[model samples]
Target: MSTEVKLSQSTAIRLEQARTKGMSDADILKAIQANDVAAFDAVSEEDYRYDEFLSYAADHGENLEVAVQDGYRITFNTRGGLGIYLEKAFGVVAEKDFAVGEGIITGLKLKPEQAEVLAERLASNWVITESKDVPEGKVLTLKLRALV
Candidate 1:
């Protein structure tokens, strides 16, 4: 088998151990799948853009996803916790988040034009996540439920 698959298998085994240790179904899955939705702390925080995005959402708000950012709209479901993670590990797929910012502006009581401008700018920055200063050991983090 390929190295990637072998690594995945190893990770899955570790996750299974955790699952047997009385961890939540979600946490176990998050550890196993290691895919987009399962992008949690540690190694995941290192590479995944969505990992950083999810962390940002906790401080700013909840419900982070793909497509929309800054103020939430249509986006991916990277925030679904362990359910998404488990499905991915088993090779099962899930629906992505899809709520356009159509009425979000009015919903948030901001002017539509103003919201549009903000969205445009935020989307621009999303491509280039402003890196944070990482310490020696801690590094940056993903703020996954498993960690907290």
Candidate 2:
């Protein structure tokens, strides 16, 4: 017995294009099976780009300690939160109001020195809100938001 799988119009078009580029059907099927191209295609453009960025960061030894929700938020560890902190702080200060930026700096608990470094980095990004201290051993909360 044999099973037949129908390809969607987009996928059919892609297969045709691959064939035109001299990719044999067996080669294309092998590539698709090996790489799970369907899964890759299902990922949103933004998520795909961010994953690529993370890979690049890892390659450069800047391994970002972070958690990502694909197309939503990216929560960075205290050490990696400086960039977002600065971006948010500058936005709030420039608006002349105390509005927290889209990203935040929160974690289990940061050392005073770690917090100071984050504050300084954020300050260099421009004006920002003051850093807050977290209680020791407090569980960090993750609030996922939709990407703008």
Candidate 3:
């Protein structure tokens, strides 16, 4: 089966930024077109484990999951880390008390640039306030609007 991932408009822009940062346009396009992880990693900065993290699998019987922390939406996968989420209350955030990964974070307002920076560091589909899914074999958790 093909394990390719399509790029969202934001992701495409992110790739474009990396390509313009000195990488070869041809190579960038190839990675985007094929959804190549290694290709993306080549252009990404060091310390970006999101690719591996994205493919990671949490130990069995774990609550590990990926979530948009404050957002009601969550997913169950094998990744481990923090995911950003939107709370019911506007501009409100809450850090969930997770077991494996760093907890969640809420009420922290970031500018577009800040979010972009975080996106690079996280290498996630989107910024997650805190997540441990995929790595933990569970769905995300955004129970409340208060810090864990």
Choose the strongest candidate by lDDT. Answer: 3
In candidate 3 the C-alpha lDDT for residue 47 amounts to: 36
Q: What does the lDDT come to for candidate 3?
A: 0.34
Error of 3 at 57 (Å): 12
The TM-score that candidate 1 achieves is 0.18
lDDT of each: 0.29, 0.32, 0.34
Task: Score residue 54 of candidate 2 by CA lDDT.
Answer: 30
Candidate maximizing TM-score: 3
Which structure is stronger by TM-score: 1 or 3?
3
lDDT tens digits, residue span 1-148, model 1 = 0111111222332333333345455553443334343433333322232333333444543322221122222222233422233232322233322112211111112233433432332211122112233232111112222323
TM-score (C-alpha, index-matched) for candidate 3:
0.25
What is the Cα-based lDDT of residue 67 in candidate 2?
12
Candidate 2: lDDT of 17? 42
In model 3, which regions exceed 4 Å deviation? Answer: 1-32, 50-80, 83-106, 111-148
Q: Could you tell me the lDDT of residue 27 within candidate 1? A: 56
TM-score of 2: 0.23
- Candidates 2 and 3 compared by TM-score, better number: 3
